[model samples]
Target: MQVSYIVALLALLAVTATAQPFLPGTGFLPLGNLRTTDNGGPYNISLLTVQANEIKGGLAAKQNFTDKDIVHFLTNVECLEGLFDTWGTFGHGFNNNLTLGGPTPIGARKANLSDAVRPFMEEVALNEQGHALFTRQAGSDLPCPPIDFTGGFNKYFGAAYNLTGNDTIESKFGAPFDPFLNDECYLLSVLSLEELGATGNKGLTALLTNPVIANGVAGLATSATAQATVQRMLLWERRNNTVYPFNETVQQVFARISALRDSLDGPQMDDQGLVNTDPRTIAVPDYYVNMIPTDVRGLTFSRTPQQLINILTLGSPDGVGVFFPKGLYGAINKPTGFNVSASGLDSFPSSGAKVASQLSTQQIGTLPGPMLPPNVTGELDLTQSLTGTLDNGTAATRGYTIIPPGMPYFSNASQVAVAYPLQTGSSNASSNGSYAYGGRRFF
Candidate 1:
């Protein structure tokens, strides 16, 4: 009887080992025998089975724009390409000099860059190259227009500082304000381009019709914002450091450059510097670390294509200016006298005080820029430096304590990880190219 029972148990185990689970539509075969072909196999879900009417319907779903709208979009793309290409050229020149010993001397003058700063410069140059390539791929067919990096800086810097002659830097400060001359100058030049790229792409986002194209532009804007933020942080760290031959602190130079941009980009206060005396709007104390420049709602500022051209052309009525001697390669290269009215719109309150009264105290703050120190004419002291140690014995960190305006601050990675736990269970294909759950299959 015992021998007969053992034989029956052995037969039951063999049957169980060879058995396969039943699927809803597919008959049972091997344990994991679900397979699919290029034509979607047993499921019969082939693109060839789709009707011509379906294809037409899919194509018709796309939004169509007028010729004028197309031209506007294309022109914005071209402007972005131009900006990226120019910055890439600047970065490439600086990086190439590094290969030949170090940053090449501009005439007899030279600037020193630390190991920490050099890597960031190299990365920014490469990033600009990527940005230009992507912009060209997106529809910017125009070649880079004539750029005046050398004479352009001399001309624009002179206008900004109220200096006379083309050799403004040489006459007023003994050395030219050449970006390639030093790390500070290079960073400042890059900052200007980056800010424009960010604002330009952001302004165009709402006008884009295609989701894929709009997403691409939004990505470019985000990257430009990140690049600008890093550059600003680096400059703010060296706010007290002096620019060569100018006898002005880095912060002072930033203020002047920002002022130049604001002056040329119409009456709108769209530009800002490293520091400001504005009272803190958010819950933090009256700390003045102007790293991320934003509007009252903590939103990034946007610039119309025309306003961007104004700054690029140094407010040239004929369009041609310092950066692009022959003007930008697009229809929107010239400013159209489209200035935002200083008064609030008819639909909104005219007085800023009225607007402030409506909003909570946590949301009130002045505009960025005009970062001149209160009543100080000489170089800014260490007290103004973002990275400088405070007299109260607290260490100044890189980014703000409260980021993105209202979100609670996460002090470290552990806090973030705890707040947003990692999800378990991944979707992966089996060894036989079938899904783990065995419903879908791939060739």
Candidate 2:
């Protein structure tokens, strides 16, 4: 009986082994063997290869965007486009005049830009132009707003330093903080703009939904970040060099500018200087250089559209401040009451107090009288034609039409209430603690 049982068990094992080969869904089928029937016909092989347009269309359809969503997306895109346009124009203007034109209002002699730094500045300008082009293609049609590179810089810088008349800037720094005056000034200006651009782009990534559009924005953010990094590296190299006429070093100026920007953009300490000033924070070899501005997690800081507007406007809660005198041409152009001061006029010098008061009373979208010359020219024309080849070897003409004007501007009071519902309280404690540097945490 035992012999019979053993033979039966062996037979069962052999049957199971043989059946395993034919088990359901157990083996891979050859590609040739796989077939599909649709409408009583064989599947078309051409459908296997998906096209770029089809994917984009599918993603857009899936999003099912509403009017509000479209408006928000366009606003963000137009803001970015305007920023690139301004930067590109500034770069071109700088390149056109390599030397400091004349002494500042204070009669301080300016230094010359070295040949070595010219190429880098040119590259930044070209990259900005490319960025503008890409954003234009992506769907921004707002014309370039009036930019006040000369007077704007002076007014903002004066506000930062609390300088009122000719003597303050000239007596102290031997200059009036003119960006086009020297290499140091040019670099400082570039650093300020690029860092803001990088942070703004980083903020936009979270709001974008369409994968294609998000990918394009991601590319822009990456480029802006790289530009900012290059500027910081350059500034770090010149950290110890004395800013002409001033008793302060280049790094000290960097810190002051950073502090000013931080103050303008609400109470957050999102900006950073070239050097690490905190003694409690620990690093190997006492890390003093801060090449990248980041938070506790080593992540780059981001700013909302409102915060960015505040900085551009020199802390003006309303639009029509420095950089963009006429204000941006999109829905996100208006500022919320999240600047250095609730009124946005406290930072202005005595000379600008009247203008600030006038601007404060003006309604949103009301174009202020051109206080400064529209020195920065060149608009993003939609009729501009781009020639390219399609994937299937066919010629294609990629053209864009002007996006219609943004939705009517929101009321200033409504914008303020909606944007910043809760007023942030002041905190004197430093946000940058030793815990950020991987040091011992008291909590």
Model 2, runs deviating above 4 Å:
1-112, 164-174, 279-287, 337-443
TM-score of candidate 1 against the unseen true structure: 0.55
lDDT of 1 at 216: 78
Per-candidate RMSD, Å? 20.7, 24.4
1-443 per-residue lDDT for model 2 (tens digits): 99976875565455334321233332211111011122111111222111111122222222333323333433433333334333433432222221114111221222356776766766776676566555556665544455566666666666556566564566667656666566777677778777777776665565566677777766767887887788788877777776654556677677667767767654334566676442111110123456776542245666555566777777666667666666666555554433212222122222211111111111212222442224221111101111221221100100011112221111110100011112223232124311111121210
Model 2: colliding residue pairs: none
Candidate 1 regions off by >4 Å? 1-112, 164-167, 280-287, 340-443
Clashes of each: 0, 0
The local distance difference test score of each candidate is 0.48, 0.46
